[model samples]
Target: MDRLERVLKGKLEDSPGASCYWWMGNWRGRGDLADLVLKSRRVLEESGFREGMRLGILMPNCPMVLALSIACWSLGGAVAPMNARSGAEALLRTISILDLHGVAYVEDRPEIGEALSRAGMPSAPCGLEGPLRPFTGRGASELDDPDTAVVFSTSGTTGLPKAVPISHGNILNNVTSSIEHVEFLRPGEVMLNALPNFHTLGYSVSGILPLVGDIAQAILPSFVPADSALSAINAAKVTGIVAVPTMLSMLMGAVLRGGERPEGVSFIISGGDKLNVDMDRRCQELLGAPILEGYGLTECSPVVSINPSYDSRRLGTVGTMIRGYEHQIRDLEGNLLDDASEGVLWLKGPSITRGYFRDPVNTAARFKDGWFDTGDVVRIQDGYITVLDRATDIIIVGGFNVYPQEVEMALMEHPAVSQAVAVGESNSMTGQVVKAFVVLKEGQEASPRPDNRLRQGEAGAFQGAPKGGHPKGAAPVQHRQGEPQSA
Candidate 1:
């Protein structure tokens, strides 16, 4: 395997003039990035992170994390990026899953470094160590076959999370695929790095990929205050960035709260959550950028479908299939569904992982049928697919299929509702009843209205009220001979 060193060399030799990399606070140039990566690489190479060694990476979202990632990859070590806030249980679990040889953490933060040092003091584990210095040391050995660049625990959101084993090939392919799909990543466009680095989206879009691909990345410590992201764009004169729907919502709120948005931004790429059309429109009003949502998961090396940067976007849909991926929807019986019909969405592509890390059972089960089961119910209409619900969260309500997302989306439309999650309740009469938990908008009451009292499974469902209750004669839905009534 040629590995990341070859790729980095290719970028430096190939795109030397690409000044758009990491914009850390006041630093907004490529020379700094190249120097930083080189230094970090030396430290890593000296630390014995040779080929096939697994190294755990724990750090917050910053330029240092990006440099360290590139450094580890350069040394042919498997880089596992873990969340800094992760508890001891999650950390130990991650280490075990990756079969991590040892861990390397940033000593830049005093508090965190102290905690991690204390955490590691109890045991005298035999693992590599390096002194804290501005990246400098010997490079990797002269001759050795390259290995996988990084590994990360699977999102497990769909099931028991497995540690995902991604090769340098996987990362390169994903980055290439995204660059192909995005189209207008200009030579000098500034990007806001907001998503967590531990996630596939974070490390891909903001960390290593953009630098290698020659895009300017402005780092925000995190995306908590959309103001920080927006302010960076305004001050840095940034163009666009990739972010989640929640950040967009918060940005829109910030704009509504009497703050002007960064004027130069054309648009942003949204992922990792559902895109709200209402919020997107709000963004179009505030930021002047159409919020384009892409569908993806950790298994696909993350990206699957994305709305083209310049195309007219569809509401309630996460755009067209990404390049080099065959995406389809299929029913439970493993039969493929036609357009406009709903089914489990499945994908097969070059970006798809070879398998889970060290778990052949999951690999076989998830990859056996020639497609990865997304476990998401969706409908493809006119080349646009709308995600209906997660298969695990679908509710069977009174013998009728009631998708919780449908209810939640409907309820979200109400002016008083801020957020809603619908779950199933086991019932004596009905198999399950849809019960919604809502966080109302400020100043709104959860009090039920008179119209809300109308009974379900009765005449009030569609036609009219019962005969005696109506001012005039009305037809109640009548049950014919031996027919079962809903109520």
Candidate 2:
């Protein structure tokens, strides 16, 4: 048996009656989970699932995701999880790229059914409570690597989605290293798995970590409706939360609107994007838990570094690298830099993937000499990593590099501003100038003219500020929930 199967079986044997997963106000025991995995495996086999094939799963975060993944792995197949919220066109593109043997989707989404039917791909309607119904498609074929456990779809540097196959060994290494590095993942603690399963961070950290680490978890289909999430957290007595910064923001907003804070939360693990300082401070003040921000990329089994604990964490850095990773800092021209310098990050380790599934061009471009180039520019000071910005997101203002996160942080210093995103606008003189889109706090009005206080604050906070004045463009816009406003 693979390590995942061995550990899961051991967990079940050790605690058959212990609650393993909590969903929709009900808890399922470890034995119950084991039975579901067995039933799912039988159903899949009866439906023509075979060893060495890839099965596509289109669903939110739920018990079925874990059940089906375990079942596939046991049968020597892999599971490829696609974003259910991604519309039919995007879903169709993913299906074509992965060339899956079969797919299982939630009962809803008739459009997806239609697309699958048009494409002649075998599919089934799946849910938390029913026997899976089979559909017809091509026969299973042997995979290049039968040890592949999960295949995730991620957009490459060209802005097109590609398939990344993560083996069982990769996941086991990450989970083991993370548990050893972070101290809070104890058996009795309940982790809130609110992030979507389609995201790598969600799958690896929130979804799989708790299971293999023998910790009980509360699973939410989605993180929206913060009031509902809060209820689940309280009901499960959750101790840890792994989510993106935006989810924390929404939960905080709900609290500000008179919702009760979740009880017993020890720490909030924030990743998927840069966690703003204001949001971190607000979490501490309102939720009574410290936000331990982390940094990762989809290609690196999703987690590279994280703030290990509340007592040992530095506010601005993502803490030290996890165990077993060898890293180097490289200049833009590919020359290696000193340990304390700032530049693009390159990583090599057991958890790092070999390459993309079949795109040799992209694989060749990114993976070189056993090191994967993570396109994020970061500064490492005494082992703590401070992610500066994405190399592609940097703007050049008359030969000076301007990091957008710095500008956004400066803009957010104003009390009236609730959120900010900075981008580059074309300018004849500087080649590119900073442009900012600001969202004001509720009941706050934008000033007709630029505020001197804000200007002075920016002058001090932003060292890379373009000469002469504030960012060339500042526009107030309405805040759209869950929609990223980036260039």
lDDT of 2 by residue, 1-487 (tens): 2557667878876888989999888998998888878888888888777777889988788888898898888787889988754434446667778878888888765555656777788888887644556666465544557788889886555545677888888899888888888888777888999787877888889989998888899999887789888888898899998877657877888899988798788888887666666778888777768788887776778789988888889988888889989999998877899978889999999888899988998899888899998888999987899988666665655323445665566567677777777777776444466777777778876566556545533533112334445543323233333333865
The C-alpha TM-scores of every prediction are 0.72, 0.80
Best by TM-score: 2
User: How large is the C-alpha RMSD of every model relative to the true structure?
Assistant: 13.8, 11.3
Model 1 C-alpha lDDT versus the unseen true structure: 0.61
Q: How many residue pairs clash per model?
A: 2, 0
lDDT of 1 at 78: 62
Worst 10 residues of 1 by lDDT: 121-130
Question: Which segments of model 1 are wrong by more than 4 Å?
Answer: 1-3, 13-18, 108-147, 155-161, 338-340, 393-487
**Candidate 1 residue lDDT tens string, 9-61:** 66665655556444445744554555666876775666555766666666557
